[model samples]
Target: MSDHQKTEGDQSATQDSMRPESPEAAAHPRRLKSFVIRSGRKTAGQQAAYDTLWPKLGLDPGTPLRDSRSPGRESAPLVIEVGFGMGQSLAEMALAAPETDFVGIEVHPPGVGSLCLQIQTSEIGNIRIYQHDAVEVFEGCVDDASVDRIQVYFPDPWHKKRHHKRRLIQPEFTAMLAAKLKPGGLLHLATDWEHYAHHMYDVLAAEPTLENLAEDKFVERPEWRPETKFERRGQKLGHGVYDLLFRKR
Candidate 1:
């Protein structure tokens, strides 16, 4: 069956079920969440990739990621990306940085399937995926001080005033993420929403363990990050993009 067909089938089974508890929530018992489940369709090719490739590339949230090596050599730097939509940029980065091991955490199934297809078609070996809440992945699976870099690009802005509580770059979340980073590890964030950018700056600045790398409040977009489709749409709408780089102290 096609990905969309599978999703449609799965939705019927899950639609009446209560939302699954996040690992973080189970650990700490919190109601706040940065993302909501959305229904999305996937192609037949993507579904095929999920059925064939997910077993090899998927990581269970209950299992901790140990041993950074992928079969042959010494451990390489580990980069974890949160909420990689459709896995385009994550795959691009994995292709560009062969020496770096990449782990992506995303809740959406179609995105995971799309990424699996990319890994299969491109023969990319350095990237693995966790189809779970990023908070849960960080709190449960990721080791403390094990990551070299963390990337959060264009996270849901949660634009309404009341919805601001759902923004991902809050002080508490920043501190939690900081704890998982090795000293001197980098946290890179990019957003087209100016208000969210400022919020990120303030929250990150309050964390004693993190230091902003920008000379000013925001830094220029680094060359390594490819322009995503959402970014292009934002550009067309005259929204400014902000990049923030922070190093763990």
Candidate 2:
């Protein structure tokens, strides 16, 4: 996840001089955007969330994020969820773990608006959002070794063989994700695509700084991740789900 990260790969080749995340990121190889901007219209409720709830929950990626918890919960764990589509599972997770603060990223407006609504109806405070490209959010905003958990649930698979380059779980990016975690911090992923699952496994496995929590190829879905409408739809289609959990070494 730039939290559970997209293109689950990233971007149009970007020029540092234009929208640079930081001087250091620009110094690295030019990056390609993996995910496409999805088009969708928001409901009136969702629009309202953006108008009202956003002021409370929205984040500025240019600003450094520190201690992402409510008052007196200074020691709460920090969790990042990348590509949180529609935000139901993420909002549920926040409710289930009030002791943790969740920072969610999604480039799409509808998803951000949907999540904003969830936060309002649920009346949850520990959840915040960055309605921007997750890549820049991580590179520019989140501090290295600051997060306790990073969860990327079902990023765009970019299923076409030629489009595999657009998949998010690449070597350099996986290495960056590893660097974001505190030692022993957890990285959890879930996908319904079997091919993408293997791809995710191989990329994460190759990261020198990460250790797989499951001895086998996959793990049972953990309790914290509520079953999402998307997952249920996949299930009805006979698609299998795979969960992968790893720890920072």
- The digit string of per-residue lDDT tens for model 1 on 24-77 reads 856885464445677876789999998998888888888888743467533688
Please provide, for model 2 over 152-232, each residue's C-alpha lDDT reduced to its tens digit, 9 standing for 90 to 100: 888777666755766787887788878999999999988887999999999999999999999798999998889876678
- Candidate 2 off by > 4 Å: 1-30, 67-69
TM-scores for candidates 1 onward, in order: 0.86, 0.85
lDDT (CA) per prediction: 0.80, 0.80
In model 1, what lDDT does residue 207 have? 92
Per model, state how many residue pairs clash. 0, 15
Q: Clashing residue pairs, candidate 1?
A: none
Question: What 10-residue stretch in candidate 1 is worst by lDDT?
Answer: 1-10
Q: Candidate 1 at 73: error in angstroms?
A: 5.2
